[model samples]
Target: MRRSPWATLTVLALAQFIVVLDVTIVNVALPRIQTDLDFTADGLQWVISAYTLVFGGFLLLGGRAADLLGSRRVFLTGLALFGVTLLVAGLAGTPGALIAARAVQGLGGALMSPAALSILTVTFAHGRQRNIAMGVWGGLAGLGGTLGVVAGGLLVDSLSWRWVFFVNVPVVVALIAATPLIIRAVARRSGHGFDLLGSVLSTAGLLALVYGVVRAEPVGWGSAEVVGCLAAGVVLLAAFVAVEARSAAPLVPLRLFRSRALSSSSGALALNGASFLAMFFLTAIYLQQVRGASALRTGMEILPMGAAAILVAVVTPPLVHRFGTRTVQLCGAALSALSLLLLAGTGADSGYASHLLPGLILFGAGVIAVGVPAQIAAVVDVEHHEAGAASGVVTAFYQVGGALGLALATTLSVSRSHAALADGMAQQQALVEGFHRGLLVAAAFAVVNVVVTLASPRIAPSAEQIAEAAATA
Candidate 1:
């Protein structure tokens, strides 16, 4: 019997949701994890960073593997590994063990994410079907962050922090059992080799760069250790680019940047991601630190944003159809900038109902407006065979932007607080000063996104045109 395409898409979407949720789930659980594992103040970031580094580093390689090996095979293998990793992470006795397990989970996610996306690209015949499918995919991806916070709060409050990891096991098991019946098998392509050197250089360079940025607050930018890591990271990335230019089977095809829409959309996405991640991290902290809210209250307070985002995501396709992708994206960027500006006014005395909710709604709407169009534009011209790789590249940069954004916000916040402390300001005043500085930085990043979005190509292909191109490819 033939498998149902809808079933395949459903399973794939669920898998993707799980992977993305894991990326943010640990945020709410950080305090709990710290208390249980005896983690130092600096070590708290590692819980999130460990997963991000491995996931971002191997994503290109994972996409290539899905193409060469076989999507179904890789998908199943990744699911199994992911389940095991989650189990190990949940059962971990020490911080080191948990971090290692998180890294392993990231490896599995890198493999699974591209494979799931590749399956969707092939299974869903392009046109309105593909557009709707992509919209659902994008929506689920957006919802992952919100659900992570809510779910993490419930689990952490009701059960143990380990339940956060354990919850993934049943989901993985169900997916593995049903996958064969839902997803069709694609024939494996031949004549491709792994770009091992390129992978190594890219991964190591990114890890080093992130480390340097994260440590800058404590060690100071002038420290030899920080300088050495940053310098080495740059040299390694340069080498990676050189290798890609010369290699027969490059992990990242430099030619992808030739398309103006693709290039501009990618740049805009990086900036957008930086702002979105910064907002999430900062808001989570603000609710806890300033308002003295519990995890549940913080998660609930942010529910308005998620609700607004869902409404926008639902309306976005028709808006794009009417106004064209470029116009919608430009509008989205402008609105996001305005949202950030509004958020910058938030202070200790501000109420969520009066001050924060409006900003949250605007932020949600703006992000959906920009996010959908930018995502669509990024993959507009790619061949079907390269769709997975294209998606991988976009996701990688998004994660990179997220990690760097958090580090950047942290740095600004710390610097402002430090200066205020040196000036003999009250602790509360210093913290508020830091938060304000971070908000301004985030707003600046969003404004940069506006410029990048404007540079995107004005031409918007119809659903029919997109389907025709995919069919021929």
Candidate 2:
């Protein structure tokens, strides 16, 4: 008997959820890991950055592989590699060993993510089924981020920081076992050579850029090391563009940017990521540092945002249907910006219910609103055969944007806090001032998202219309 499409979707979603959950699960455990491993203040960040840099850098290549090779094979291989790397990371005793393992885990994630999405794209026929599948995919992606915080808090408080990585082992095992039964085998494309040159240039370029930005707080941006890294990154990225323009088989087809919807949606995703990442980082610190909450309490305080986001995600489809994707996206962006502004005003003495709850709820709702519509618009106009590539590009931008935002926020917050400390302010007051600055920056990014979303073309296909079109096609 064949597996139902819904079953296939569920399996794919679970795989993706596991991959995304790792992104935030490690945040709550960072302090614990630092104490255990004796990591330097700057060294601690590498734990997260190592994973993101490798994941973002190799995503395009991974997507292309799924298209040229078989998605199922790549998916299984990725899962196996990810599981192994996670095991190594969990068992790591030294900071160097953990960072290396994290980099390997990221490489595995880069492979798995695109392959999983490609499977979903091919498994579900376009129309109502595809829409529903995408909605579930987006929701799970959002929920994964939330779960990371809560799960990390629980594991870090009870067991050990290593449990965060150890947890992925069982999930990967289950997915690998079930994948063959759920996913249909597809023919591989022949005569599609991998764009080795383009991949090298792009990956190296992105890694260099991220490394430079992340190092700027410890090594001043004006320092020779920082400047050299930034310059090398720019030059390599420029070479990558030149290589792509001339290559017969490019890793990322430069022409895809010609699509107005894809371009707009990608831009919106970047801005959304920038704001959302900053919001999460600053709020986590604010809850812990300024309010003097424990890791568990801080995680619990942010639970409302996660719950609100899930609820809003459930209702987004109908809202999009009624008012159109553009309207909802713009509204969501506006709300997010407002929430950021509210957070920007929060002082050291501010109460969670009076100052934080309203902003968090508004931000959560806005994030879900922007997330669903932006994703819908991204693939709406993409070619069916290139769905994997398209999805990979979106995912890469999302991760890259997040990394950049966090790096910037970290630098800004630290600088502000140091300056306030120099001025004889209390530690809590200095931290709150730094958080306010960070939230203000997040608000500015949210405003940018609103403008970009408004520039996007309308997406208002009814469920019946979509189903009819899919059936006819």
Candidate 3:
């Protein structure tokens, strides 16, 4: 029986939104969580780091499982685990319990997010239909980050902090009920069993790498712990590559990288993700430290950016249909760099409407234009079975890149602030100076992406090529 494509899209997109939302939803609630749970300043970061590290680590395994075991099965399993952890975190009696639950939640996100995206590829045939679906999906991916900030502020302010975790219950219940009707089951598999060695190497390598990048902010880049983890991660990732080359059912097929365009697309997505994350971090700081706003106010102030992203996201798919992915991508990157430049010009005295709003809107549109198109190009040439793996890789870039970018930006901000303070600048003045420094670096990243996109061969993959890839998969 054929299911309604739009309905499937809604389910998949909503599932992903909630998963991504969790990434930042707990951020604003941390103060309250700390008060209730006796969390110290140093230990509190674990709330965020635990989830992201595990999430980055397990994404490949989860995506491959969706393909081998079946999307429906993997999706439901992840949903169940996520729901269970949500409840555990909500009802936890101690800081340790909640942190542990959050870690599990990250693993749950790793399992569900890629499987949900994979379902979209098979549900909507490639071309206009898939492009539109991806537009919405990619838009939500962009929106979720901003939405998480706003949603966290709203929930934490109006209700108890526990509500942040508890809010997922009804949504999870509804998704589980709708799963059988909306999701198509994959055919029974006859193949080599799961690649245990590949999964371990990939997961461990990513875990170590993300951890090192994250730790770099507080520990500094040269710390022994950071260096050891990064070195270990490099070695493990290298081993994973060698293992994937030999395995029959590799977690990440090496052939996927055979296309230079696809590989470039992934790298571009990482750069885009890095810029977007760092931009938001700096803006949030501007609102809070410079403007003297509360968490709720900061969230409200950021709302305009998310709205702009949604508007552009809706229109970008059709634009891509008419204009092509490369054109859209290049234009988006150029605009993003401009937006960062505008942001960099601001200071403690800049007004919201005059100085900030224009750039915020530009950034909103810029992220959608670059992100949606880059995602489309990445999977446009892949087969259905490979869709899950491809989705996993794409999302991993977004996750890992965002973490690394935030760490880099945070480090820059701290160093710049210290330098300014040493020169006898006021604390708030020094903070804004740091924000400028970070935004400038982020803009540089956007410029580099534009350069890379221009330098790459124009793929302009046609409808027939897409059809052939789908049929072969």
* Candidate number of the best TM-score: 1
lDDT of candidate model 1 versus the reference: 0.79
Task: State the local distance difference test value for candidate 3.
Answer: 0.77
lDDT of each: 0.79, 0.80, 0.77
Identify the candidate with maximal lDDT. 2
Model 2 Cα lDDT, one tens digit per residue, 1-473: 77788888888888889887988787767767877899864456567767876787788777778878898898888889999999999999999999999988988998898788778878878767786787688668778978888898888788998999999799899888898988887667676688878867877887787778767767788989889999999999999999989888887788888888788878888788778877886787677657777667777778788888989877876777788779999999999999999989988778889989999989999987887777666666777665445656776777767666666666677777778999999888888888887788888889989889878999885755333322211
Residue-level lDDT of model 1, residues 302-417, one tens digit each, is: 87888888888778766776777789988888888898788878887798898899998999889878877776666766665565456567767776676677667767777787
TM-score of every candidate: 0.91, 0.89, 0.83
| Candidate 1 pairs with clashing backbones | none
Give Cα distance to truth, residue 330, candidate 3, Å: 1.7
For candidate 3, what is the total of clashing residue pairs?
0
Superior candidate under lDDT, 1 versus 3: 1
Candidates sorted by TM-score, best first: 1, 2, 3
Candidate 3 segments whose C-alpha is farther than 4 A from its true place = 1-10, 27-53, 89-100, 117-147, 177-186, 214-220, 381-388, 418-425, 461-473
**Per-residue lDDT of model 3, residues 147-217, tens digit only:** 88788778877888788889978899899999999887865345776777976787678767766765665
**Candidate 2 or 1, higher TM-score:** 1
Please identify model 2 stretches exceeding 4 Å from their true place: 1-10, 39-43, 125-139, 180-184, 382-388, 458-473
Winner by lDDT between candidate 3 and candidate 2: 2
* All models, RMSD in angstroms: 2.9, 3.2, 3.9
